[model samples]
Target: MRMVQKPSSVVLASLKPSTYTNRTPRAGTLPAHRLAGVSKPDAPYSSRRAPRCGLVGRTFSPFTIVLLVILGGVVATAAQEDERATVEPTLARRAATLILARCAVCHTTDLIVQQRLPEDRWTATVEKMVHWGADLTKDEAAVLLQYLTARYHPGAPDHLPSIENELAMTEPLRGQTTATDGPLTGLAARGAGLYAHNCQACHGEGAVGGVGPKLARNTILKNDGVFWETVLHGRGPMPAWGSVLSHQDIADIHAWLATR
Candidate 1:
């Protein structure tokens, strides 16, 4: 039987740790720049990761807060304005009650407000209303006359009032107004203003015939009944002033025209 022979001493020594020190490695080592490209920390840096796709919009919260505040203010103001308009008072109901109960039996509030009389004239007017069957006491009569004259004649109220009450009050008691009872007095003084308004355009400035015949110069005035008839009938384009004018106002105007 033959046995295997041992390896050479040189070959056995080549397997030792440092025997192949001169040999070149088969793979090349990478530079620091190439290794750094792939390397990362445990977490990404805020500056380097495409800014984390910033979908967390930072301005959204402040804008939403301001918008809500503006809407709230508008709604509150509208509610206040609605409350005021819905509750405002009307005058016709309040003043009409007082006028109808206190003064309507003999004279209307219309008759009282229309006459621009002074306080003294209104005192006389209250006395006349009393004579004409107005059921007013001395105190009620004074307050009413004061209110009438103060409301109509010139001057603001002594104290500012916080309310408005309408009255259709105009003219003195229609049945008893005369030259003295009305605001102005006398025929010539009264008729000039009246004729300027009513008759001057048609009958000339002072009743000289124009569109209508001369009222003063005509033969009608010589007969009182005829004059009265002509005035009431309104013979031409002239209107019937007899019904509209107070009796004394008619007589004063007639007396004034006679001189013209």
Candidate 2:
């Protein structure tokens, strides 16, 4: 029979589960089982190894953590861009409507559409108009300002459906007046342009009438109060211009139409 040596007290003490559980093994030190020349049983998985499926037990390098953060930011920015694209067109349409309904009342659309101004200048212009009696709520003014800056910025293309073309088409008809009539001057001249822009569309060239009733020789022009009331408050099918045209603007238009 082969003789076996008794295990030392130190080796037996180190073999206890409490020894391994209570303290980490020193570097270069072997487990008690390895030192004793006994093989450890194979575990299904090692607790020291990183988990394959989840973030648990994982240790990322500094570079990897930074890269993950960058990716998350990229995703968030892309989502915001998509949302802005969806909302921009609707806001643009609303802005266009406000411009037509409000700005076009006093001056022709061409006056507003022709200029390419920067944001600060546009803001100043809009504010000036408000100060001068434009009827716009704070919200409406803000929306209009945003639209003007975006669509009429210095870098933007010129507005289309050319004002020059419209002017050319109406100029000849506008120039023709009765042999007894004198040349237009002052507020009357200004009103000619306003009438052409605002009234000619429905009232026909020189307010001769088409969709709207004839105003060329309409007796309504004889009474200032009736004319102001009808134009500002609207008639049967006409929309009110009270919120758009200032008193001075309506007066100028009246001065010009009286000639027609």
Candidate 3:
């Protein structure tokens, strides 16, 4: 075979720049790098291998650790709030429905929420509303009272400490004559049984003293309004019974307490 001769340097220099530029890269081959008019050999590219098991040589960064800890604490606190805010029972739910439909007509939900009245006061307030044309049936009224007294009673455990301390500090002096000593008859005489059923446990058998202070000769009885308001709205440790007792029942009890 005849050998081909290499081109002389002079002939090679005479070639146009396009001659080299027109050359195509071979299949599966990368182009060479050029810097400062010098050609550089193409280097073989080796990709980084993935770590064994994806974390054999890895370590958690400080920021990542802190982020994880914060997420955990937030999850824990949210769980606690969920547990504390469980739904009301069936009777309570029915009462809420009635209250929303009837009470919301003339009053705001917040107004009802803000009041921590007793069963007695709740009863009185409801009776007054009925008298004012609230149009609630007797059964509906009873359910509403159950819900109100159970949920917003002044004697709620949350208020117990503060109320107890206040009442204890404000006890009246011994031997002070009360307006309850005034002549009271008829309705009061009939109220004796009612008082025994409703008031005796906390107020004592003769209203002398028990969990509550002595109702006998107490200053609260001097004014009818004050006495009724105290029983309806509650004072210090005493819970309001306005929801539980009828206006007539409260009046009767008031009369009975006067006799006591």
Candidate 4:
């Protein structure tokens, strides 16, 4: 084998550290200064720093962090309160509907609205009503009780007028027959259907009395004027039918009741 000759000093001098130091680094390779934990002396200077990410990279004072946490908690609490406010009104409306459908069958709304009682008394009253043929389910009764207690409690405001006060204020109409009154012979058949639809619910089948006074053999039937006044202008829990029924309709109902 022939011996290899050594490189010249000029060639070695030309291949100095400065030549490759300024060159761009290859892909997937670390620069000498970075790998050795050293910085380049002639590198471009910059005031801007590399962007950081995530909570770990962020810096906040203890007070600022606590304030942010408190604000978040407040927002969460307010959202919960708003949800409760919305739900409460929905429940109240449902309960009110139940009361109107079920309770108003026997008694008027004014009778119920005027009373102010405790929860226990309300419970007793509700039980009594259920016993007296109020068609209420267990859940419906419970919901109704909750509504009554909330709205008609002892501490609640007495805004509605008393039924006794209302009755006392109004004078009884005397001899108040309508112009449509006539012979009751031919009209009784038509009046039967009208009475069944309008008056039968409260007055009982054949005017024998249920919630209202028994119309069977009642002296008021003989007097056409008093009957007309009572029917047209409401009495106690009875609603005024003047707005609902025509004069002929009232006369027809009267004719049917007279036969009963």
Q: Pick the candidate with the highest lDDT.
A: 4
Collision pairs in model 4: none
Query: lDDT tens string, model 1, 39-156?
Result: 3443546455433323255555433433443343354334323322222122222223334434543344456445544566767877886787665556455445534433433222
Between candidates 2 and 4, the TM-score winner: 4
Candidate No. with top TM-score? 4
- TM accuracy, model 4: 0.36
lDDT per residue for candidate 3 within 1-260, as digits (tens), equals 11122212112222222221122222233222211223334335312323311234568643343344345435433432332122133444345545544564455355666665656788898899889866467777766665565445442222222322322333333332223344444388767887885667568988997877888888777787787777665566555454445566677887888887
Worst 10 residues of 1 by lDDT: 1-10
TM-score of each: 0.29, 0.33, 0.33, 0.36
Residue range with the least summed lDDT across 10 consecutive positions in model 3: 1-10
**Clashing pairs in model 2, backbone N/Cα/C closer than 3 A:** none
C-alpha lDDT of all candidate models, in order:
0.44, 0.55, 0.51, 0.57
Poorly placed runs, candidate 4 (over 4 Å):
1-105, 111-186
**Model 3, residue 107: displacement in angstroms?**
30
Specify the poorest-scoring 10-residue window by lDDT in model 2: 1-10
Q: Report the error of model 3 at residue 117, Å.
A: 26
Clashes of each: 6, 0, 15, 0
lDDT per residue, candidate 4, 1-260, as tens digits? 11122212112222222221122222345444443444345424322322221134568643344444345445433433332232244345445555544676677667788776667788899999999978677777877776565555443343633433333233243434465545444377888987776777788999999888898789998897888788876677776555345677777777878887
**Residue 112 error, candidate 3, Å:** 20
What lDDT is reached at residue 60 by model 2?
71
